[model samples]
Target: MFQSDFLRKFRILLVLVRRDYALQYAGSALGLTWMFLQNLSLVLIYTIVFYFLGIRTQGEDPLAYFAYVLSGLLFWVPLQEYLIRGTGILTDNRQLIKRSPLGPEIFLWIPFIQFLLHWAITAVPILAFLLWAGKLGGIGLPISFLCVFCTGLFVACLQSYLARINIILRDISPLVRLMTQFLFWGLPILYESKGILGKLNLLNPLFYPLETFRSFLLSGYESKAAFTDFLPFLILFLAIFFLSRARLNQIVLDHL
Candidate 1:
């Protein structure tokens, strides 16, 4: 019974994932092919432009610099999706959510599904390049994936509240999008950290994990972070997740 139930839920989840992905490129003629290339094209644009600039994050090796930009965009794009799309999720699907009692819980997985798809579509080439560049090895690759998985959970927990907050405030959606633009510059992806901003990088909750993962992937050592760097963020986010989850249920039931 349990196995059957799990399988049923799994199939439903897959269908939802497919539907959402399709909706994203609904009017496009090529559809899935174009959907697959969109994220890769963005990464390629950044990689080519930066690699051509003669800026060297990994000594003078151009390939390593390519890997650097590739890895940054590979992760950063989905995070932007989570913040922007996730905040408006409730409002976007008010029709479905209002009909199904379990709506919010299920819809919460949509952003995560999109992340997995984006990663999966690019995973082969990304892993191959990392391998060819000697940036990943046996357990190292799995560890990198672990970092990505943890990040998925972090964003889901975060949006648990952000989604609810937007339903109430409405302005938060635009604000999140605007701030995300600033955050991209803030993250140490495009340039090396320097001076006051570099010092303040430690305080940004997203900074440590991303920096640690980047350093670990490139050089196999974490120069920018310790475990405790993101611990407080995790703790606070979990607390907010639980409280917000309860309140969200209340708001949906009582108001929406």
Candidate 2:
């Protein structure tokens, strides 16, 4: 009975994800193509500005530098979308929570699925580019994806807490947006990772996964340090998830 019920819920979640995806791009002139276009445009703009300014990674040719930036954005974009879009997810879906038999956790999956879809779509050209540049590796891709999945799980746990808080505060959504912008500049996205930023990379929660993804794509090798750095986050995620699971339903009911 439990297995059947779980399967039933999974089907419903897929429906919700598909509907949300369609609705998001419904009125856009370019529709889903805009997703690719937007990412490409940003890459081009950043590459032009940085290249003209004579910023180059040591020993890396121009193509490698461009790949580094592009690879970094691959992880960054999805991470950014997850946090910003998920901030008010529960509040945004209050009606569904009130009416639907599905768990409130289903709302969290919607944004994650959307972000993954966007990332998958954007990765096609990136993967092709890496292959053409002779930088793609067989083992690196799978390992990089595993790291990304772990990072997503970590984000989901924290987002669960934030989503619950946002219901009462109402200010969290804007704050998260502002914070992500600051993080974008603070992270080693445009500049080469060296000096103080390189030292801090070991400590910054976002740096490991970003570098893991970037390094794997650019050099066909994953960073052992990144895997090690993620252990703390994994521990934190488990603690938060266990603590919050019991109380989350109650909080939602009180807020609704």
Index of the highest-lDDT prediction: 2
lDDT minimum window of 10 residues, candidate 1: 216-225
lDDT of each: 0.73, 0.73
Residue-wise lDDT of candidate 1 within 1-256, one digit each (tens)?
9999888777777877777767777998888788568776876677567677656555656776677777776668777877787777677766777887566677777777777666667666777777887876456566666777678788788887888887776548878888888878777776656687787676777787687667656655355656687789889889899999876777754545
Candidate 2 per-residue C-alpha lDDT over 1-256 given as tens digits, one digit per residue, 9 for 90 to 100: 9999889877887898777667668988887788788877865676675444446656567676667677777778878888987877778777878888766788878777777776776677677777787777666567667767767877888788778778767648888998788778767777666788767666666776777776656665445345667689678877887677777767766776
Winning candidate number (TM-score): 1
Q: TM per model?
A: 0.87, 0.86
CA lDDT for candidate 2? 0.73
Q: Which runs in model 1 stand beyond 4 Å of their true positions?
A: 1-4, 55-59
Cα displacement (angstroms), candidate 2, residue 57, comes to 4.5
| lDDT at 245, model 1 | 85
